[model samples]
Target: METGIYLIVTIVNKGWGDTVLEASMKAGAEGGTILLGRGVGIHEKQTILGISIEPEKEVVLSVTYPDKKDAILQEIVRAAELKKPGAGIAFVVPIAQVAGVVHLFHQGSQSNSEETK
Candidate 1:
């Protein structure tokens, strides 16, 4: 596997942004970016009746060491209560390249591992 970090973004129902951020941070993430969005799914009924449903959402993005991805994801899931339906979704995307933070990543990894051990 190529050695690099990952950025995890959790898109959840509105008002959960702070929870996600706190969870990630508690799991060894420094901080993250938050964005507002609108989610659309099954807006109308199949029958003749016309009904619409839209969900307001918040997207929380965080970057962390590849080794810490799993912990961070779990924290977010629990904090956001993602197990329940209509809560939200979480996913990770690989970061092929980065700059100016290699040292920070190494230091954080060391600190976290030491604490765990």
Candidate 2:
């Protein structure tokens, strides 16, 4: 089977996981998984005006069809306001094979084996 499968990973402030999910869903994403984490940047140990802190962040992992990848990514970016520095960052990677999600899609859409979600 040949398909265009893409995994979108978005990282943002701890409280922004739902925001990303909502935005993505509106833009055609079915669902995603959220993970909580603590991040240490290169400047994490540095003092900002004499203050140091460890920041907590949320990671959202979404998988989608190729046709919906760009729209979903853009919505997440807009909702997260990631254009500004330090807001957050997102990237995409392709998946060569996938399983356990075959039941989530509608039957009519399964005809084209080239782009199953």
Candidate 3:
């Protein structure tokens, strides 16, 4: 298990995934993963022609060391304007174990990546 590693999950409007990724990277994260999702938030409800609309969302996951967590999250919030209503949310969770991302701990090691294949 890897201690001191955190996973920052940021969910924002569809087109902002790239912004979150860029922000996290600028704040010292190596990279992040973006996933497509759909849901309607209380402040994001919409309708057109008497039909309901479910907003599309982008789920961004950034894994980083403890030291980089705060900076990355701050940048994400600032870049995404998360403080405003319907701007989306960001949170962090501790990671118990990690694999296939050896580069974060070992600059040149590829063992974990190779073993997976």
Look at candidate 3 and tell me the lDDT of residue 64. 89
Return the lDDT, model 3, position 62. Answer: 91
lDDT of 2 at 76: 94
* Ordered list by lDDT, greatest first: 3, 2, 1
Q: Can you give the lDDT of residue 97 in candidate 1?
A: 53
Tens-place lDDT per residue, model 2, 24-92, is 999998899999987765434545887777699899999888889999999999999998777788999
Pick the TM-score winner. Answer: 3
Give the per-residue lDDT of model 3 (tens digit) for 17-117.
Answer: 99999999999999999999999888999999989999999999998888889999999999999999999999999977677766665542355345433
lDDT by residue (60-114, candidate 1, tens digit) is: 9998777889999999999898888667889999976565555544654565334
Worst 10 residues of 2 by lDDT: 105-114
- The TM-score measured for candidate 2 stands at 0.78
Name the Cα RMSD for model 1: 6.8
Question: Which of the predicted structures, 2 or 3, would earn the higher lDDT when compared with the native?
Answer: 3
Error of 2 at 48 (Å): 9.6
On TM-score, the stronger of 2 and 3 is: 3
